[model samples]
Target: MWWDIVKVLYIATRWPWPVEMGRQRMIVQTLEFAATLGEVHLLSFGDPPTKPAPDFISSSGMLEMSGLMGIAGSMLRRPLLPLQSHLFLNGPATAAVMEAAERIRPDVIVFDMARLSHLALAIHRHYPGIRLVLDMDDRLSKRYQRMLTNETAGDLGGTFEARLPGAIRFLVPRLKKLLLRVEKSLMDRSERRAADVFDAILMVSALEADEMRTDCPGRADVVAFPPLINELPVPQQDFSRSVRFVFIGNAGYAPNAEALELLDRAAVQVSKNTGSSDTDYCFQAAGKPLAHAVYKKVEVAGFVPDLSAFLAGNAVLVAPILQGTGIKTKIIDALEHSVPVITTPVGAEGLGLTEGEHFICVLGEDDLAQACLHIIRSPEARGGLARMAAAARNKGLTSQNRTILRDRLTFAFGL
Candidate 1:
């Protein structure tokens, strides 16, 4: 603690009301930890909360700056300006943010997500002395670029099954690629700009921080904002007795939706290939409802009220996330709960947890199905994975993890 108290005015691109997704979790956790230092106020680009906010939020307001025309104009102007700038630096939002800042007049201003990076810079211009921090959470530019490339490869040589729809799909991919290219370029520029402007740039992992520096050069004061588990759930004693494997995440998001689809298809394949009926094993996915339908055997346990209890009770967590950037908070949550996880390397990135040590990492659907079967069949393997996860959580991501973030902030602001 550098001072008796330090007031922070936090701004976010989206309202993290329910705190269901990874970014929301990060924002909430960061605010909760920051409250330990001093009072925190919030301004977000969404409808204001219907009810009172948490105690940590000294005050809050909405930045309803985007309308249909503004969004379309932003898209149209993306090639001319940074996408984030056009989206967030519009007249209304900027005025609202600056006005809020003027009223709050805090020691520090924290912006959540790259969309708000421009807002942070604008705030700094008005209040030069206030320390600025940008919580990027993920390298979104890289994510969009990767997705564009993947889509191009997947759809470039497509056959016209339904001629009109197929042609439309083909054109859509190219259009998306063009748009993504603009976004990537804009995002890169914005990252560098944020690096130069903000006092600190926060990433979810060290790897992501290093990557950001490649473009940002000397000015990128990137800090790793790894998750903190306040308490690790008591490890489930037996695995053989447990019958269900669970996957937890917001399925409305594309990456998690694809993962759920993969799980569903894999479960179907496992049934046919292994001569085991759906009754042999159960896969329960708990989170937001999937955008697409899943196999009957793969149950959607939408929005589990008590995630801790659900995670503690589940035998294994199947996180077959094939695409996405940043660390999957669900995986970390599972680990903190001592639930063995099966995931791909992409899902396990930045965690530094070794394959077959903290949890099993498998490639593709077949390998995933086999891994699940192995866990179901062998309690010893499940227990072993659970023990390793518990050890890793205790060693790295416990309640004490908050100190790391607080220290980083202290250093950033010269507190």
Candidate 2:
């Protein structure tokens, strides 16, 4: 039988069974789909207490031991922990994976991220017959480099060249830039190696797929398989409350922190400008605390596990994100729950959503306030946006889309 012939192994950097963040959500969704094709085995780092999955063997103890080694390795290498993690945990993880492969004699192995591609390469090196699939969730190297640069730039207060007036400033900015470049180069090499060794590379978006093709050329087959959202029943809610805008995301992230800060200032100004003295007109912020000051006006609902129920009570979901890459899973989650979204251009990427029809897109503080005001005062407008969001969910999670993902997985693994 096809299932008998194809025993697939999935290797991930983090535990996937318990979907928490966007990456985990993608991992879980992919695993769910992959399970339907054949017998799926998962190997990941130690499971979090809050998040756990039912399938596969977990060898996370190795990762913990690797972390201890990473601290010792840091003395030799500047960023020793991260490097050691890549080397130690990945090496042992790969070894254990190979042993499993030898026992199970699986036809193929699916690596969930570029970080775990080390395992895929190891499998290819030992068992040359086994096909390997690389799941490129994001351009990790580029994303990290971008984050470092943005942080450095923010600290420098201006461009590197422009800020080099003081005696120490010249060397400081140059050193930071050089370090970032080196990090990017090293990660780029790892990514390239992973791409070259893998039989196929799967990405979450067309933009990301194009990037991988440009980087690795003909060495790997790159395809974009978007994350799927399971259709959940949304309870009817009263949209008659005073303008209460909701923003959902892990607030610990820098981009989200900045978005919440922007929303806080904008919301305060909007409330005052509109002459609305009602406290009911407020901003409800969900997720962990990023910045202390930003939590002042914003009502913090820390990490609501039951997101659908949380959305059921909220009026409109706001994603005022200014930066980040890939699709916003929060936006999709909100749309799936029939909650109207008002987001920035960056927040609404890759969803193929029409601005007004699907949700509102506001660029500036005033525009965001105005949009909130419109939605709050007009119940009909809010209802229309909610209906459009429900429609988007229907189109995104159709059976045809699931088949596309299944076919891609089958072909990639030669099942």
Candidate 1 pairs with clashing backbones = none
Model 1 C-alpha lDDT per residue in residues 217-303, reported as the tens digit of each score: 756478877777556547554554555677888776777777887888777766665553322467888988855564656888898
Q: How close is candidate 1 to the true structure, as a TM-score?
A: 0.87
State each model's CA lDDT, in order.
0.72, 0.66
lDDT, candidate 2, equals 0.66
TM-score of 2: 0.80
Query: Can you tell me which runs of candidate 2 are displaced by over 4 Å?
Result: 1-5, 47-52, 55-65, 68-91, 145-179, 277-280, 290-294, 364-366, 377-380, 398-401
What would you estimate as the lDDT of candidate 1? 0.72
lDDT of 2 by residue, 140-257 (tens): 6666565575652322212122212244344544566665565556667777776678888887776777887887676678877777655678757666555468888766566676
Q: Where does model 1 exceed 4 Å of error?
A: 1-4, 72-79, 152-174, 273-280, 398-400
Write down the worst ten-residue block by lDDT for model 1.
Answer: 155-164
